[model samples]
Target: MRLIEGTYGIAVLHADFPDRIVVARNGSPVVLGIGEKEMFVASDIAALVAHTRQIVTLDDGEMATLKADDFRTYTTEGTRTTAEPTTVEWEAASYDMGGHDTYMHKEIHEQAEAVDRVLRGRIDDRFSTVHLGGLNLDAREARRIRRVKILGCGTSYHAGMIGAQMIEELARIPADAEPASEFRYRNAVVDPDTLYIAVSQSGETYDVLAAVQELKRKGARVLGVVNVVGSAIAREADGGIYVHAGPEVCVVSTKCFTNTTVAFALLALHLGRTRDLSVRDGRRIIEGLRRLPGQIAEIMEQEEEIKKLALEYAEARSMLFIGRVRGYPVAREASLKLKEVSYIHAEAYPASELKHGPLALIEPALPTVAIVPDDDLLEKNRAAMEEIKARSGRIVAVAHREQEKADHTVVVPKNEDELDPILLGIPLQLLAYHTALALGRDIDKPRNLAKSVTVE
Candidate 1:
């Protein structure tokens, strides 16, 4: 017998013998499936759903030995235990790889269901509360949280930005977002009273992992908002809520981004209801949360229109994206997606900063994608749109309401003020995907990028 231990979670499997093998999990996820005279194991549930849904989810500090006929469970301390197998009801069609033309398009369309999946079984209807068991913070502790600091990289960082906003608006918590890569370099102050959240789709992103490790080393509590189960960050963090976005096959993120933002909403609702947020307000947010999946579907129906619109701007030499507050992160993420899949040169800036520098670049030759959420910033976003129009720049507006100034308008379904960003992001995703398709660029494997960034 070998003892495998680490500061974070670890999954080890011994396959030296054919008939029997040892599997153990610390912080990461390991699911076992029982069949007739055969058993299967994997870190991701998606990989096993096709074969069997009768799964036993191994908790932290648990081990299992699989033989030809049966499996036995034990604790890390070597005590024999019993783990019941649960039959899960999941659609096998969701995991079918070859159904769509490209993984990017397939994952893009999966957002509605992906967002719905993350919200499943989480909301309490009677109390209008959200329960996130992984948060490990009770109402009393939650009420006392001094602040929230979120960390992530690339797409995850954009999601974290939205998360920071949700926490501030819904939970009334002081919150901010920083890039995990930069956070690790600065030796940032680690406060025990503040909740630190590390966001990563893979949960194995090196920068996010390093940031979590450093925060843990400093005795600061850390939580993970991650997609992949049992990933390094998921194991290392004290506790966390999984995004449960399933497998994101596209190098450029689509479903994961939307789902992560929804996860933040759930977390925010959990924190908000725990504090001073009234049940009336909580129910409003809860209803808004429930409306997201349908709203995403409504936005998706504009695919043909978005495809035609993409063709109109596919020839642009460069592009600009602008928004304010909640919309800024959506623009940033949209710009990244455009650059990644379409290989277009794109820049994103807060709408208020247009005159600061980016506004000068607006001209007939360049295009700007503007996010116009129907919030207090609506007037400011309109002013920015007029500014871009003054420079003869072609404008493509994503808004809850029609914008007369926009050269083209993609109207998205409206939600609560705080949830508008989540809805607005979907249209931009379709824009990016369709633009890449129009340009004949490799949608799945864009020029030099990997799905997960494991290195610095």
Candidate 2:
């Protein structure tokens, strides 16, 4: 296991010696759990928490030997390592369905509470700022940050895109997001003045972890925005925000995605406060953050309506999702959720780009989902919907007001424009769930996709 060249985790059961089990990991995670008269090993802690919270995490180059009553940890180089077991705080029932039919459905509803958990004890009302205790960077280091580069993959990448926009708008920093999968292969430039942030739901994503290592080796400062306490990326990064979304058993992300965006909002708020952001404006954002939990629950109230829309769209051959600016990332994530859970073909495009290419696909048979936040982009989005309606395409808009041109509308409660993306996303989760249900697809475990991509 020590000489393994790539990301791998293996467990071997000796046929002759049934009592002994050997497990090793290179780039992947391995957790050994201790229980009364039993032992367990899994790639994720969520699986082990149900039986035993006392567990030991194996590092990249570590291997372990397990027995019914005891376990031993060591390096593959024939050196012994101390295997200390620590008790995780989560309960066994965290993984349960809690009366929901599927984990996706449960997580969708959990967003309100999950978001509140992420916001708890983090806001500074007196200073009108956000206080992230885990972020090791102080005001001095933060003031030196000239740019922001957020790296992640899939859904995490989308969240980073939103974070970048917030930082650029609020803190006046040059910010952008890059897919971590391609970051290492391209030999990315590491700028000392640029604050690098790695985002991950599992904190065990292999691509993000590798990118962090490469950045550190080049003498760049990096932080992490991650879930799962003590996971690989969480352990490796200099400092970051712990998005407390709790146990998400669903393969498709819902609560974590929302929590991560809120986490970014906090980071952006903190950075902004250190710079030119005023106390008044910071209080506005802070108030907006407080309103999210109630607003999310309000959106969840529309589940039956969204389910109807899902059933209608589920019969389509394909779907188109569109938004402008901040809403663009929302469109992309919504498209991803729909495709992932419902197995439907979906494409997201910036509203401005429709006339350039995607406009050709508009027709009556195809449905369009538009994110039309009532911000500065309202008129532009309305114009795009007019364009789609001109082509006889049926439209469903997620917006603050009912769209005149849209055949159907998913009305969302408005917040600060920077915070609109958080609320606009909740209904789409329900859409994906009911659509998958209508199609009889497996909602929790989508085929060919793992909850965490540990292997590159």
Residue pairs in clash, model 2: none
**Which lDDT values do the candidates have, in the order given?**
0.86, 0.92
TM-score of each: 0.84, 0.97
The TM-score that candidate 2 achieves is 0.97
Q: Provide the global lDDT of candidate 2 against the true structure.
A: 0.92
The list of candidate 1 runs beyond 4 A from truth reads: 1-93
lDDT of 1 by residue, 320-363 (tens): 99999999999999999999999989999999999998877888
Q: Count the backbone clashes (under 3 Å) in each candidate.
A: 3, 0
What is the lDDT for 216 in model 1? 90
**TM accuracy, model 1:** 0.84
